[model samples]
Structure formats: C-alpha cells, structure tokens
Target: MKISRTIHMTNSGRKHKTNKIKSIYNNMLAEFKRGEIGYSTIAILGQSCLGSIAVILLLMNDMPTMIKMVQLFLVTVFCMAFNGAVLAQLKSKITFDLLIATILLSACVIVTNLV
Candidate 1:
C-alpha cells in the first residue's frame, strides 16, 4: 500500500487565503499625537457656538471684571491649543488659528462677562 501527500500547488490559492485581512495596525502608538486630526470643522463650529452662549450667560450674570479677564486668558489659551491641533493635522505643521478664533473667543467672553 502507498500513500500520497499533497501540498498547495498554486500561487493564486495562497494569495487568496491572505486576502481576508486588509490593513495593519500598530498597537504601540498613542492616539491624537502631533499632526493628528483632532476633530472635524463641524465639531469646532459647535464648540465655538457653545462658547458664544457661555459668554452671553456671563454677561447676563454681571460677573466680576477680574473673573472676566481670567476667563479671557484661559479662553485664548484653549483656543490656541484647539486651532493648533487642527492646523497641525491639515497642514502637517505646527500652526494655529489663533489669529481669529482666539481673539474672537476672548473678546466675546470678556465683553459678555463685563456687561
């Protein structure tokens, strides 16, 4: 009696078996690093809208000037960080949208709080 052993004989068969898995993911990296896409424009737009509302509320409450000033500083810093994250992703460089967003948010917060 004789026995025969068969092996996979075609390149196409071997290639077909590996077609199930698509991408390779590295598990050692952290999420949202530099040059990372932090959030979409819609999300940032929403955040800005919320900030505007907060400023309006502060104005209605007649908050202290000192508090307003501090809030302004914090708002500026936060805006810079937020815009930097987006620009870093889009332009692949450490840029900031501070020119507009930061100033506008700070002014809004401070002006609203003062009133």
Candidate 2:
C-alpha cells in the first residue's frame, strides 16, 4: 500500500509511483466498465493471431491476400513489441497490458512459424 521505503526519491518519487499504480487500476476498472478487454490486450493478441493465421494461409496456397495480411500483422507485431518494451519501464496498467500482448504475439509467431 504505502511503499514506505524511499528507494528512489522522497515523497515526490513515491507519490509518482503511487499515482501511476492508481491510474493503472482506474484504467482497468474503466475497461471493465466499458465492457472492453483493454484495447492494448486486444490489439497485441489479435494482431499476432491474425498474422499467424495469415502465415498458415500463405503456406497452404500463397494467396495474394495472405501477403498483405502478413505485412499488416508484422507491422502490428512490431508496434506492439515496442509498446511492450516501453511499458516494461513504466509503472502503469500499460505494463500488464503490454505484457499480455507480448505473450500473445510471441505465441502467434512461434505457432505460425512452426505451421
């Protein structure tokens, strides 16, 4: 709760971290209220999954659309990966959101590559 230790700064630093956590919690609650599963989570996981599917389709017959889909998926994967890395340094809801997205992306890439 309080995080009583002054590891970084004094009240100012602790206050910032506490605020960051609060913001994250609020964002999570807002997502729940809107009946949304956190946009970041959806984007990361969805794009990756789509990419994997596209790759599979490409391997099956190499359709033209598959190429476009793979390109789109790759873009999304890269964007989400960058966001995840940034969030890894932040103390906010985005961190969890990004982490989930990273996992989804990794899973999709691995599965699709195998396929």
Best by TM-score: 1
Q: What does candidate 1's lDDT look like per residue over 1-111, in tens digits?
A: 677687757676454433322212112112223323443364357556656665566646655788866775677466657655665655422323332355467566656
Per-residue accuracy of model 2 over 1-115 as CA lDDT, tens digit each: 7767756645754534458787886776566445434654565466556655645544565347766477547646665564655445444345555555555655655555456
Q: Number of clashes in every candidate structure?
A: 0, 0
Stretches of model 1 off by over 4 angstroms after superposition: 1-39, 90-115
Clash number for candidate 1 = 0
- Which candidate tops lDDT? 2
lDDT at residue 103 of model 2 (Cα atoms):
52
User: How many clashes show up in model 2?
Assistant: 0
Q: Residue pairs in steric clash, candidate 1?
A: none
